[model samples]
Target: MLQSDVPIRVHANWRPLDPGVLGSAGPATYSRNFAGAPLTNTWYPIALANRIAGSDLAPNSVDINCNFSSVFNNWYFGTDGNPPVNQYDLMSVVLHELGHGLGFTGTMTVNNNGVGSWGGGTAFPVAYDRFGVNGSGQQLVSTSLFPNPSIALGQQLTSGTLFFNGTAARIANGGASPRIYAPSPFDPGSSFAHLDEATFPKGNPNSLMTPQIGTNEAIHSPGAIGMGVLQDLGWTFTTAMMADDSDGEKVGCCGTGKSAMMQDLKMPDAEQARLVDAAVELTKASVDQDDPKFYEQLSQSLMQLKQARSESIPVEPVNDAEESRRVFQPMRLRTTTPETERISVADDPVWRDNFIKWLSLPRRDRLRIWGGAPVLAGEFEHCVAVGGGGRFCCTGTLVAPRVVITAAHCFHLGCIGSRGEVYFGLNSNNPGTGRVVACKCVPHPDYKLSTDEHDIAVLILDQPVTDVAPCPIATPSQIDDAFFLRLAGFGLTETGRSGRKMQVEVVVASNNCSSSSHQSTFGCKRDREIVAGGNGLDSCNGDSGGPAYVDVGGRFLLAGATSRAAANSQRGCGDGGIYVRIDKELEWIESVVAAEGLSIACDSEDESEEQSNSGSVKKE
Candidate 1:
């Protein structure tokens, strides 16, 4: 049984002029000719059998002029087998036409540039509702008569309102050479739906309208399969077979193999035009023999023509924002939090990069901070100096087997050539104590130096280690400021101590203050203090990308990273480290981790919730 899925209602009052419509050679003359052999490798649709009112009409040839009762919709089928003058098969032709009618065939158009290119400029045709044939007052012309000399086989139903989207019109009876016209197809009251030029097969040489058919064969043949025709329109097979397999021998459709039709217009159009134009100009030059100026004039004229056409047809810009947006997903927290705890990430430091007086006003801008006391911390761990001259560096966490998570900016430029190592599971002043692996840095694409959008990075290790346990990534539900987080990183020991990767001593800080950074409609943020060193709580130079984790329900919930600080701002080793906001971007981080096929290490969700609610107090 044929599997029917997307059923479309058949149009009522569907009546075809002929089973096999013939075409003329040129548009100027009306002539009669014998019909070609019936297309056998295709299927045809008769009226719907269930919808027929009375007699059953077998699939047979009928007079083209006669119309009988149809089975389904408003179709008419001729039942008698009279070998009628212009009669033909009913089911076959309707099936083929219905393919176009039901949006099965593709639509496309090709424009010929007489001397520039081998094939014409091709484009997908728009199936507008204006060109439908099921309208009243349509003056159907005999297939024997060409509509216009240039437009060999076109139909014009409406006058002023109908047109072939701006082509010249013509009268039947072979008055004018056939030319495709838009006037008759777009009558003011006409509904030209689903009629597109691209539906026709392109590049077929043997056609009624093709020059090869000539006047003698034109009156009896269908037009060439131009641009968009498909065999599936009438064929019973779900897919068109590339070749005959009767002998069990396989053959390709085109000469030996069937390949999908692929025409890249942008890649070859300009080059093809250039070559053709040059060759034609050269031929003209040779024809002019001694006159170089004449050949130059011809070339210039062709260039001018191209310029004029380009000026007439303006190109529209294709919007790519939708394509770009498809790569990102909406972020949300899985668990609910109290509205009171939802706030921004952190506050700016008090000191700012003040503007200096200049003779000619040197163009320079600096960070300007308003207020807030510096929260400080004592010591740090698992951090390192990245670049040479203290220009750039960041903090990181050794999370998994051969995996470290850090900010995206620290190793972006340097890691492209060489990766920095991770020093973890040890306090400052010692090296090579923890599992040290060569880091393989992966920076997020959205990471930018200017905006610092996705300032997160992942470090792949040459080998996995088992010494230290990794931290669990916070889910949408676990993002809360009720649990104060622990921060550790390799930053400067003091303000002036630059080269040393000194670890900071731990200090407890409130996740309370409101920062202006992480305030978005989607997720909540904690602007509280981080790992401050001297006067500040959290992180410094080597702490920029370091993790800020809270012990929630016995599991570590990473809340933030040390991202920035005020210009020349100084605090205790634990008091002044500004961290990159992590909780607000957990979804993004999760996507990246999932894409890399890496699993995060942490405790169970229920355990975390129970522990947080129990109010378990701990000393760092």
Candidate 2:
């Protein structure tokens, strides 16, 4: 039932650990401690659950150790109800193991001779140790033999006398207490870590969290007793109650109340209002018919609310100094074409004062060009050539230190040769001086060659580039027709192919460009593609995958990436072309960056700063 935009990273590669050293399928550890401070509120349990779902912390790392021996090869990996009798259900095993990662297992570590400790002698106890007791009904932490509370509980677990003494668990298990597994000869990974295998045997209704798995068995739910144990150990449920009415009073399992969960989330006013209305409607439906589906709907609403809240949190660039340098300082404007107005610039006082000071470059260093006009020396530093063998096949923008955002067709066109190299700061025509080989190129999963629905791909570099700063991506609300964008790339121009990078100011014609051939060959999606061109300015070949950037408060934010040229343009490359909107792919971009452990520079300044610094330039 847990849902969120953030992905829980799973590392499933084969490890060569001896089976005798680690007995279970895997082990789970918390990346960060949720034991104290702000984490101790009534809504702590729900917030913890959400944190586990979206955590980027190292302590949240869960390692699943698998024995890849030939004996385990016959495992059934499908979801069908019927399988071969000899096949083991891999899904059920994985579900149980994931439960351990989600706070089912204890954090205590014990030695061979029954000596125990936790948190490296700090003796900190997790929620699980609070309910543990000895055979004589003495609470483990209250025992006199051990002065330290964590050691006392660890000794109890090592002694094989620990049992869950919570009233909820006892009532759920038919009046018998649930015992923790602890045999005479202590097992490091197996002992003190699981439910008593004898009491909750495999194939038993409550055997999902037990130590062993039997043949042809499937556990769909974590039975009534299992839920009780989890509830006792500081875990909250989305349902109205943890057990039957007789066990305890119905509690608000989402948090202390719905209001608390809402307080934790920061969403737009419109989205928050909509979610509130949906929750109210679902609550009324559940009150009327008691349908289980209502619970799921409510859960999804909460998840969506949480996701909106996370996305609303603004990201800031790592280096504010570098970000300030990339801001385009307007000088003078000129009407380049009947439909185009260019923001013309020369090596003026403002450029020398700002550009030279920021980049620490020699004042005498003159701007150079291949076949186009001179560009601001540092304005398009984030632009790079994404091809191999010192050739500029296609252009890309570095949104992250190690990630390059580009057009999917760049790869489809075979422009990105094998062992592709990403040339950064290729200001001159020469591409040899600065280049990094790409480690992987991941196209959008839904990218279609025929229609180009999601014409985007992310290239991960072998290492991060340190010379140039990355550009910030625009939000969906930021891409309007009122603003003109600068299209920069090392692509072909009116004369011929440009060895150096060039840029031109162009206005957005129509967000949705339509034609008979374009409609038939590629579906026109206004929200995902921006049609912009005017005054003999357009993105041509070799420009595929380059950036269409808008100057927002001096910062060059990426609004779109070059997708394709419109088919019906009479001027060929002069008319407006299609650029994949970056805002539409923000979520996918963030997810991929998080999964790949890449750092993207974001604008972290407050809204007031962005508003006060907004500058105006001539419209195209």
> How high is the CA lDDT of each candidate model?
0.31, 0.50
- Best of the candidates, TM-score: 2
lDDT for 534 (candidate 2): 32
Expressed as tens digits, the lDDT of each residue in 1-620 for candidate 2 is 54333444443322111111111232222222333322222212222343533533333332322222121345677876344676556666666655554445543455455565433222234444445567887754443654553445556666766787665677777776788777665544455556777888756788777765544766767777777766654445666234544645432121110011000101123533654676546534525223434433432332232212111110111112222222211100111122232111111122222221322322222111111333446678888767654555677898776888987776766666434778776442443445555646777877766667678888888887766777766654556532456788876543232445777555454443333224421223656777555324467667778898866666677888987665434443554566788767766766777688654544443243432233211111
The 10-residue segment with the lowest total lDDT in model 2: 257-266
Residue ranges of candidate 1 with Cα displaced over 4 Å:
1-393, 412-418, 425-435, 475-479, 498-534, 553-556, 566-577, 605-620
Could you tell me which residue pairs clash in candidate 2?
30-59, 31-59, 31-60, 316-602, 316-603, 316-604, 317-602, 327-554
Q: Candidate 1, which ten residues in sequence have the lowest lDDT sum?
A: 23-32
TM-score of 1: 0.31
